[model samples]
Target: MTASDDPVLTEVTGRTGRLTLNRPRALNALTHPMVRRIAETLDAWEHDPAVRTVVLTGAGARGLCAGGDIRAVHDDIRAGGGAASAAFWRDEYRLNARIARYPKPYVAFMDGIVMGGGVGVSAHGTVRIVTERTRLAMPETGIGFVPDVGGTHLLALAPGELGTYLALTGQPVGAGDALRCGLADHFVPAGRLPDLLTALAGRDVHDVLADFVGEAPPGRLDAHRAWIDHAFAADTVEEIVDRLLGSGRPAAQEAAAALLAASPTSLKVTLAALRGAPGLGPLEAVLEQEYRVSCAALSAPDLAEGIRAQVIDKDRTPRWSPASLAEVTDDDVARFFAPPAGRPLRLATGAAPQEVPW
Candidate 1:
């Protein structure tokens, strides 16, 4: 790979197959090539007797990963690579499914900001580690995209209507909240990471984690759970927003504003995805539905406009089509959920051994 297309660093260290996302400059934002490389490495190591576990981390101090490189998707749209973007999503989603179902133990070191596609890479692993500095979210609606990466599946399982609140608002939560919400399994300080990595080399995954797992910082989500569940229990985004507005609390009012600021179509479709996720059978099924939404997004003006406003122009102002929630019809949401005309997500089967399915 060239400098622009740098491969994610992969190596076999002792009994561990280690994968480090090396693109610190862009927050290790995943590329299609990077996704393919990771999947290939995992496939090779799955059956290797010497490699009993896999450890995934990022190279920088700032964060583990931010998300997918959507700036490239913006360029693709400008260059009319609608088909290319679709292919990229297809492969990325398949890799996500693979990681979730890997035969061996998988651990993720989510040290910092982990969002969108970052969650896709780490959250499905058998063990997910977060630091005090970690800030996690699936902030897709801000950019006119629905939560993909099996996010809807995981978010759907969060206690009460917390999933709907997160899906619509795209709020960042800290390590404590991450653990409280089931996004992370362990908490380790950033300073202790090196020692933790060293421990992984000589000990079992569970044993090492048990030794290093410290007291998780307190999370406010539990305190706010009642309000969140009450405000977000409505069937639609509009009703949720109305409920928040009526609550008269500053936090509730702020949440209402956040929901209003997001792309209408994204908000509507994401809510639909979250509500529908619980009924979806498995990670593969969630990914299949997400593939349809992602492919459908290529033709939607909001995805391109959202990217241009957020990434290309570096402006926070996005002019979403169907600018208001009321303008987003049920039909508009249904179009996104519908399967596309071309080939669907190709999920591999029968080649891997039995283990705990993520």
Candidate 2:
């Protein structure tokens, strides 16, 4: 493939080594090889003193990444019970943990449309920048999947029940709300990102950011905190919905509607995952749990069916089995936390290969 034709393009300029996701046509949706490619590049860059800071940016004006190539996972499930898809996630989640603890500064230009797998790659970095154009979410519930790639870890840490609300609704948040949720560090206007990126090659990240960073637009979460915290603090999704519906708040009722439409199994599992995250110790531990939940989802009917409705058919109407929260038994949710038939994700044992941090 020509340089521009590669899925991921890597280049070193001055002290900055940049990795550009090149599949703008797919909104740089990550493939298994693309995941491996990024991990491998980080392996090399981590030890290269010349490459002081590693930068990740997308090649398009549309977004950084849409998510993982889930249609492939759908096909993988249909053909072989999702072994290949599970393997891809195992590696992908490892990469997420690597980014969180990477010794060198790893900067992500989270300009637009960061969701699912997209959130995994950038949000973990030591330096995550969001622009006015940024739209970030962990919209996996809409696809009959639980959020993976340490998403549960980040969302669990969001203030109060904001994490629970986002986990259930799968809504995209702006740069302001992203900052509020601890998903990003600095807010640089979209117009100034090019200038900020160019300066990274020569100056320290903190110094370059000071020149371009601006106050984030006010976020909505702070205003709705009282109702959100109250409604979403319930022990179960059913109660969470009951509280939201009874709150007499338009926005909260809307969130209830969104939850009603999501896959019941996914919604329940996702809640369990989010609730369990804070106790999981670290991002690596949370990822191991997410791996089990994700692999279990492969066997569930909703995953393939969800992808079919939302992606393959573009119908946006998934007929979820177990239809409602009440039908999703405690047994059903507990199964997701169990080990998959395949090997478990073993990330926390021993020293991780790339723990050097600066």
Candidate 3:
């Protein structure tokens, strides 16, 4: 119940520690500083003998986190400085890896708009709590970026070709869909979250979740699973778009519209990454592919134009470099996944590589 003075409030009650992301004005959109703070606090709590568990949540009613502060990333690009942005990504990725394999019990209250970076922070937790208000996504493609923060790993694990669909289109999944898709572990009422946290602080993590049994609200994604799988299974984004347009299914058509409106380069790279990311289980491999694609994306014309149209100009009219997916060459997509000249993608394991299921 104790609160710190930081933008991200860190508090401890008995053996439990809580970290609250506080930036409701922008839906708690994360900045580089916030990422550093969260990582620092987590590192601190990891070694603290008194803290048996850690809980992460956001302040206010709107949501947990919308995503990263793209406006800042855009500005960094505009300044013609790559090191700063690259460094931010390096640190953020490290934090994400730490969270994914944290030693202690880590719980995430994934309420509201948990997208992109929010997903990175919360989805990897031992206990992921979703509510009716939860609307989760890995929507980096919509903003002219590939999903980072170990997003590729989760995308690789999504059912069937649904990962490609969601990654390419940046679709939002509600609470039930999130649970069914393995993004969340438990579903509790939005109003009951505070009480649940209190209960968790007073008891063991598993027991706390076990005691709060409530009927999960119905999900929206399951009904459209077949459509999502079929439409997104196309080999190319253009083909996928065409199928979606031709399917006559309302959901697929809507998804197509969203994809068409997004940055063409982002859509292309995202689809390619999800397709090629399978069988890569280590978090470092996933992050490396994403980092390669991201660094290449910064130099592409579509990224700047996308940010200009969406965030800067607020015009919602972007002129993509290739203009259409058909124009995007296989070489262009390949360049993103290809290792750089000297800096190859490396995994961060100590004495021995961690054994993963797949």
Clashes of 2: 3
lDDT (Cα atoms) of all candidates against the true structure: 0.86, 0.90, 0.81
- Order the candidates by TM-score, highest first — what do you get? 2, 1, 3
Query: So what's the TM-score on candidate 1?
Result: 0.95
**Which lDDT tens digits does candidate 3 get at residues 318-338?**
788888777788888888777
Per-model TM-score, in order, reads 0.95, 0.97, 0.93
Ten-residue stretch with the least lDDT total in model 1: 349-358
Scored by lDDT, model 1 comes in at 0.86
Error of 1 at 341 (Å): 2.6
Candidate 3 lDDT score at position 132: 86
* Candidate 1 residue spans exceeding 4 A from truth: 1-5, 346-358
194-244: candidate 1 lDDT, tens digit per residue: 898888877779887877889878987788787799988888889989989
In the range 40-117, model 2's lDDT, one tens digit per residue, is 999899889889899999988999999999889989999999999998998899899888888789999999899999
> Candidate 2: what lDDT?
0.90
Residue-pair clash count for candidate 3: 0
